[model samples]
Target: MAKKVIPLTNTQVKQAKAQDKEYILSDGDGLQLKIKTTGSKTWVFKYSKPFTKKRSNIGFGVYPEVSLAQAREKRKNARELLAQDIDPKTYKDEQQLKQQEIHSNTLQVVAENWFSIKQSSISPNYAKDIWRSMELHIFPSLGKYPVASLTAPVVIAVLKKVAKEGNLETVRRLAQRLNEVMTFAVNTGLIHANSLSGIRAAFEKPAVKHMATIKPEELPELMQTLNASNLQIVTRALIEWQLHTMTRSNESAKAEWSEIDLDKKLWIIPAERMKMKREHVIPLTKQMISILSVLSSFKRPYCPYLFPSNRDPKKHINTETVNKVLRRIGYHNRLVAHGFRALASTTLNEQEFNPDVIEAALAHVDKNTVRKAYNRAEYLKHRTELMTWWSEHIEECAKGSLSVTASVVNAKFG
Candidate 1:
């Protein structure tokens, strides 16, 4: 015989009072309103596990917050799950876990985690630049979105917006960084896969704009202008040192006396200070030594840098120091400090120096990894000869006798 069941009415539920002991009021179909001795009422659903046939109770919520009608509806939903062989409690638990994951695995959260791991492998200044770029470009738009929810199209659209502002290079860099962050997210199990992998293909590739520089024939004129300018002594020496060594502006500016080995006749820049993250050994020429001697006379006791900032002796000169000097000396838009590398490359290539040795001297990363390893080991002697020749060429230009280097290069290569 089937037991008859009566459903709870709103009036009865509202008026029900808690006794000395806790008791329950049936709402039919496994729904019950339980009243505790403390007067707190709650809704509960009693059901049997689909596989084990074990009875279990799931809390719908506290009563008044969940009325009789709502409790009945929850019971009806649970019954449907039982019909489909799904446990209502397991389903609820899975949904709660998914919600927790969504709240915790946001794009910004995952990206920050990834950056923390990435910071150890790169220079502090470079790491700051990367984080600042993300703050400016990425975090504003999609930071709150869960990494699992991010799609390639969504990220590509954001990049395309950056591209529209004529910052194609910024867009390109942002794409690479964003991809790295997303890959980190995948590696850390935040997302199933890297959905943002193809986002870079959405934007136009940035144009390659070489640094502005002067032609080889104009070297003598530039040297003449540099010498005639009433520039500060230290600044002039810094420029000459950078040109002679063919090092980047910051690398030259940040040079320490300890890095210069008089016996070895080499300026050994540590890996941390180099652009390629490898130690660079520049063979010091007699002209390079002469410039160092001038700097030695001007060196402040408190400053470790060859080109200390005028405002702060503890820090090296700003990277823009050479550019500003060039602009002030009437070379605006035509030359920059970094342009010195291009100048050296052009002159050396024209003189028929081996391209591999020239690239090695410039400390450029070779595209062929195997060849790069071989060249680094094999090209030091050749690099020294080439750098010595370049310094002599710079000296001839400074003397306003550019043709002297031509005869030397011809005799050497011949």
Candidate 2:
């Protein structure tokens, strides 16, 4: 016959005194209060391994820290695990490992790790901006959560809060960053799936605000203002180069003398420096060459940039320098440095210039893969003609001889 068991009570447990050696007071169903000679008491669950039938004792916790009722609950849970053929101690170890993993794989920890890998491939300024955005916007609410526990609803809620502040652009960028980090976690086996995938649909689409630009007819007045303004000579030159080339502000500001070929009448912007990750060739007009000639005369010794910073010759001019010039000349909000590209595209397209040639001049990526592969420079001849006409047209505008009827049809090119 099996031995009868008796349950323990709080009063009996409190009255029970420690002996010279360790001893156990049974509370029935494998729950026991263990008393040590050092006057300490612990709650332990005595169970048998399901397959091996080996006895094991797993500590619930020290007594009083773990009340009798709490210890009974833990003992019941461990008994359930043993009945399911899982060793209680092994289950406890597994739970501990899972908790450790949760601690280590938090959203901020994983995001920072992912950022560390990504920072090497992107520009320093761009990387810093990405990290700054996350720190200000994302980390506060979600950083401490385990990445595995993050769900779409939780992420969307956080983003909506950011959107509520009228920072829709930041919301979009942060959503993209979140998706990237989640995808990284998925790829690295830290997550089962990317919870942020397709979450952008939940956000309101931010209104597109094209950079401010002036009408084509406004160019003559703008050019006259630029010419008559008493801004620094270098700033004035930077503005002229931006309008003449229609390059991105940063591209023009960071121009290197080595990229220009006065003999070839071309500027070959390398792939690394270009936004499209493809090399671009700009066919220089005589006016463009003259501007470069003047810039070359002022070039500092051992400096490589065409527009070196006034304070630091080793660095290029600030990317915002030309925009600031426009603002100082009272064109703020009415026009910006990037407006030149839109101005050129609009004017040339309206005049029925070959769209392909204009697009090539802008260095825009062609959507057709085969055409992009074969015809990256296909419209060079036409683009050369277009650039020459464009420069002369700019000169006519500056001289106030240009009318709305002015077109490239009358210009000569080879």
Candidate 3:
């Protein structure tokens, strides 16, 4: 044990240097001498705890920082905390309580606010998709987990389960949504960083797939088979646009007439309505342009959507309508409308286009931050050529199917 001393100085240092475990300082009354240890010289009140006057260490930091003069002042503050029965070491929690009392957002309550802020920036369909993923995959198990605890391991485990369940597409989409949500949390000062920041290292992505597109050779038969079925023309056309434009099914279904500029030969999907959150400019092939011109009479050019629902003219087409049509055409279990996007990606790659060009045409988000940080260019030239070829392939298949149907009908009549 050492006697504690106040205001270390040249004279005091000389005297204290001779021995360890020796500290000297006067008590608050300035009458009693204080004693401390060299190894751990924690300050303690010989009296009761701060709020109750029960004796305990009244932490006043270490020796030099809390001089004899300062330590006594802290002792008085400890007495103040004592009057309220609050522990001195628990001061940090008190400050946090104060922060909360002032209405600062915490990890526990920011998700819904984050959702509301983002909904308008995303397509209503995408907003719906995000909610579904959150509700099913995350909300039940993790909705209450502090956002701060959503480390890469936790997120990876969730996504890996989805991938293992043969829902690889959903695994990727969920990862994307998680990344966006945490990013919002960061921008709003809720958490310091995105929880999915190192997600790539935490989980291996499922095998990259070329779209399981029906082959051009197989497509003619499939098309003929589909054409003769009882499918709504709008639903059929919705699926038709998906193939011709190589666009995502939801994108085609939710198309707004106002987004198309026939004179410019472009269809500009606003960033807020797109998954990538960047406006995409797609060149329209002559065939696609012609299809729009014909449908334009039935769809007012200034209406809410190019494919507005017949049942609700002001609303965009239903997200599931095209898929229902596919299921009815007997491709339900075998092929999904979403699979069509992959199909185009796969088929076009086999035709020898560069990989990046094919990806951009499909509106895949850039996973490479370095590329996004530096490159400002998009794959316009390749997408133009890509879309043109895609339209030709679809139209050719539809014609083959029409020919087959005509032949069948003629035989039936005879």
In model 1, the runs with Cα more than 4 Å from the true position are 1-44, 48-54, 60-91, 366-378, 400-414
lDDT of 3 at 66: 51
- Candidate 3 achieves a global lDDT of 0.65
Residue-by-residue lDDT tens digits, candidate 3, 101-154? 334453335667778887877677667888888889877766766676677876
Query: By lDDT, who's the top model here?
Result: 1
Pairs with steric clashes in candidate 1: none
Q: What lDDT score belongs to each candidate, Candidate 1 first?
A: 0.84, 0.83, 0.65
Model 3 is weakest, by summed lDDT over 10 consecutive residues, at 10-19
The clash count for each model shown is 0, 0, 21
Error of 2 at 333 (Å): 1.4
RMSD of each: 6.2, 5.3, 11.8
Arrange candidates, best lDDT first. 1, 2, 3
User: Using TM-score as the measure, what is the rank order of every candidate, best first?
Assistant: 2, 1, 3
